[model samples]
Target: MTITVSNLQPIIAILAGILILIAPRLLNYIVAVYLIVVGLIGLGVLRHFS
Candidate 1:
């Protein structure tokens, strides 16, 4: 029942997919946010906060 860091991406992906299917217009924002988050993770920017 625990939500670990490793479990986040797939969860987010599923939610994003669902959201996109429900509202196609949100695809742009969803992708933009996902990319920004991933880029920040890649740069280790969010590591300090965790």
Candidate 2:
């Protein structure tokens, strides 16, 4: 199984949103990690074609 771009954004957004909601104090860390992960994936450092 692979993950396509179309399927990636919403999941990431929801997860980040949840984390931010659950721990408002962790927003910075969560956003940083989320951005890094998504950036790597977007840059093709990681690829999932679902």
lDDT of 2 by residue, 1-50 (tens): 66677778798789979888999999989888878877887788877532
State how far residue 14 of model 1 sits from its true place (Å).
Answer: 0.5
User: In order, what lDDT does every prediction score?
Assistant: 0.86, 0.80
Instruction: State how far residue 4 of model 2 sits from its true place (Å).
Output: 1.4
Give me the overall lDDT of model 2.
0.80
TM-score of 1: 0.82
Question: What clash pairs does model 1 have?
Answer: none
Best by lDDT: 1
RMSD of each: 2.2, 2.6
lDDT of 1 by residue, 1-45 (tens): 776556788989999999999999999999999899888877889
